[model samples]
Target: MTRGPGRWAVLSAFTVLAVVMLLPFVIVALNAVKSPAEYSSGGPLSLPHGLYLDGIVQFWQRVNFGQKLLNSLMISAAVAVLATLLSVLNAYALGIGRVRGRLWILVLFLLANTLPQEALVYPLYYIAKQVGLYDSRLAVVIIFTVIQAAFGTYLLSAVLGDFPKAIMEAAAIDGASRWRILWRVVVPISRPTLTVLMIFFFIWTWNEFFLPLVFLISNDTQTVPVALGVLQGDKMMDATMSSASSLLGIIPAVAFFLIFQRTLTRGVTVGAVK
Candidate 1:
């Protein structure tokens, strides 16, 4: 089909929006590799005179960046796996099986999703402290898993709703139990949507700052963002080195999104249609 003027206009507008959103990162990146003198004298939009590794080296050493990176990856991966499994099970039961008071159950999940983060923070802190989970990696992992699970359930349910009933009925006729149908049928057909959710949850948990800050007090257990925040809060962080560290912090997240860009688009669009 020939492209229309309206479609072209919309595309141009979207391109502009994307650039605007990306502008900060672009500026930070330029500043990261620039010397302190250049960072201060040169405009953020200016091109760098040369690449410098000092900022990155100093940032890495001071923050123990390698350890923080692993901490973030472990927490995020655990959350994604646990959240996906629990959400898929909940969604399958709700979407495919007959149950009593399903509407109320869904209403409760929606309510849980809407609860304010600020309101829950103190109570969550208390609970974690009581359980001796404060300042631990598992604490943040558990919190991320639970918080993301509500929205995950909602998104998975939407995807499952679009599934045809005939396939499930045939599976039941063949003596397939609910567990078999869920594992052998529902999951296989829902790969795209699952990929989308997994990526979304991973990114969200990986980038999470407040929960990590509240739960992780020890330097050893800190995730990337919390560790970066510590670095950024230091009096010396106003230098170009701080900007470099900030750039480093954003690199993994950007790479993850790029890798999953296709699945994310499909998953989001599919969920939206229902």
Candidate 2:
């Protein structure tokens, strides 16, 4: 089969759109290698005359970038794991289990997802203080896990609900317990959905800023986003260093997407079939 002229025209349009979208990132990467003086003199879009590593080095040392990166990775990983696990259980129960009022329960979870973090931050702050979890990485992890799980449950419920009931019935007839069937049968078939959920959880948790700023008050506990926010507020801000830090901050997320790109593409249409 060969594409017609119309298909080729559409492909060309999309190619142009992709380059337009990537322009900002290209500019940022170019500036990341320039010195602050060069950034100011040569303009943001100008290519660096030579590779200058001083900006990156200065940013890393000034902000304790290693510690911040570790903190972000740990918190994001914890949230992703916890959220994915809970979402799986919640989706199984609400989507597949013959439970009463499951639709209402799902509606409640959807509503919770709609509520902005700003609206709940004050109450959460008070609760964290009362529970002695404030200023701890565990606090951030727990908060993000719960928040991300709400959306994950909603997204995964559709996939789980669409699963074939005949297979579950067959497993049940074979004397497999519900727990065993879920772990052995449903889980294996739902790998694509789980992978998608894990990727979303990791990316969202890594990039979250507000909740971390509120819950992780201590410098040592602060994640990358909050640390970057603080860096921007310093009296003497360096444009090139800031650009370098921004680039470094996004590397983990970009790498994660690249690693799971195939899984993500496959998962998109996973539940469309039986």
For candidate 1, give the lDDT of residue 35.
87
Candidate 2, poorest ten consecutive residues by summed lDDT: 265-274
Model 2 lDDT tens row, 69-166: 99999998888899999998999998899479988988999999999999999999999899988899988888889999999898878878888999
The residue-level lDDT of candidate 2 at 233 comes to 75
TM-score of 1: 0.92
True-structure lDDT of candidate 2: 0.88
TM of each candidate vs. truth: 0.92, 0.95
lDDT minimum window of 10 residues, candidate 1: 94-103
Steric overlap count per candidate: 0, 0
Model 1, span 1-274: residue lDDT tens: 9999999999999999999999999888888888887877876777899998799998898888999999999999999999998899888877667467767777788899899878889999999989988889988888878888888887667668768999999999999998999999999878778888888899989988887888898888999999888776688775678778889899999898898888888877866674
Backbone clash tally (model 1): 0
lDDT, residue 50, model 2? 94
Which residue pairs collide, candidate 2? none
